[model samples]
Target: MRTAVCSGSFDPITLGHLDIIRRTAACFEQVWVCVSPNAEKKNQMFTPEQKLLLVKAAVAEYPNVRAELWPGLLADYAMDHGACAIVRGVRNATDWDVERELARINADLHPGLDTMLLPAAAEYEHFSSSMVREMIRYGQPLEKYLPAAAVELVRKMRTELNREEA
Candidate 1:
């Protein structure tokens, strides 16, 4: 089977992330939506477990797509999962540059691993998890940028965040 690993922090799974996951699922026999933790990233809005739950809910319709929590290097995760390629979503120039470099690094880490960059759908080109977190922090509606199943979880997290700050 041609398996692909799509790993990301997924602090909150936006529609943009779901778009990439769905496209990857269509292209590969199986796609693993990995919710990875970034020790360098200190601005996380959700826990890894929360992120995993959100991913599971978002990808429930795609039988071939499975969500996992990966704690090691992405290349290692891909190798462990028997993935032939890594699927990345590029939304703009910045994403392209970063992902391209990361892909190169992944290739270096695992000689035969391929990286596929999937462009974001035009409608979701402007959406991102960080932006959604900002919206939630300031009380903005998220229905348009996230799947219906995820909206509630985001709202609940936002409320908890508000309480924490209070």
Candidate 2:
């Protein structure tokens, strides 16, 4: 089976992220939508467990797609799972550069591992996890940004978190 790992922080999965995941799923026999746990990301709107739940809800329709949490080298995780490719979303030049460098590192870590970059759909090109968090913080409606299945959970979580802070 040709498997691919689509790893990201996914504090709250955005439409842009879903677009990339859907595209990747169509290409690979199985795709893992991994909620990457990055120590550098100190301020996360949602916990890793929450992100995993949201990702699971968002990708429920894709029979071949599974959502989970992973920390450390993404390529190594892929290898352990028998995945041959690391799929990522490239929304702009900055994202492209970062993914490109990571691709290089992944290749070095495992020579046969391939990296596939999918362009964000035009409508979701400007959407990002940070932007979604900002919208949630300001109490903006998420219908346009978040995947339909996860909108309610994200909104509810943000509201609950905000209440706790109050």
Candidate 3:
């Protein structure tokens, strides 16, 4: 069976991420929502487990979709997981540039793997996990940018952050 790894930090697994996953699922036999473990976000708000939990909850209905965490080189992880393709979501020119570079490196590292970039849906074309976090941090509603489960998680996280602040 063809498998694609749609990996990302998934800090909170926003609606934009789901949009890509749902669309990409149609093209691949199986899609793994890999919870990317990046050193840059080591001290992140959400732990990898938390991120995986969120992703699992969000994709519970999709029998072909599974969520897991992987730390280190993405290409290496995809190879280990038997993913023949990497599904990425691109929102703009900058994302295109970044994904292109990543694709080049991944392809060089794993000759058998391919990378596919899907542009974000029009309504959520501008949405991002970071943007969703920023909006929630500033007390802005993100009903459109986040799923219902994510909305609850964001609210809980906000309360926790407020408690820590106070």
TM-scores, all candidates, are 0.93, 0.95, 0.90
- The whole-model lDDT of each prediction reads 0.91, 0.90, 0.85
> Can you rank all candidates by lDDT, best first?
1, 2, 3
Give the least accurate 10-residue stretch of model 3, judged by summed lDDT: 38-47
**How well is each residue in 21-111 modelled by candidate 1, as lDDT tens digits?**
9999998999988899999877898999989998999999999999999889999999999999999999999999999999999999999
Ranked by TM-score, the better of candidates 1 and 2 is 2
Cα misplacement distance, residue 132 of candidate 3 (Å): 1.0
C-alpha lDDT (0 to 100) for residue 38 of candidate 2: 81
In order, how many clashes per candidate?
A: 0, 0, 0
Model 2, range 17-115, lDDT digits (tens) per residue? Answer: 999999999999999887888888766878889999999999999999998888767887999889999999888999999999989999999999999
Cα lDDT over the full model 2: 0.90
Candidate 3 or 2, higher TM-score: 2
TM-score of 1: 0.93
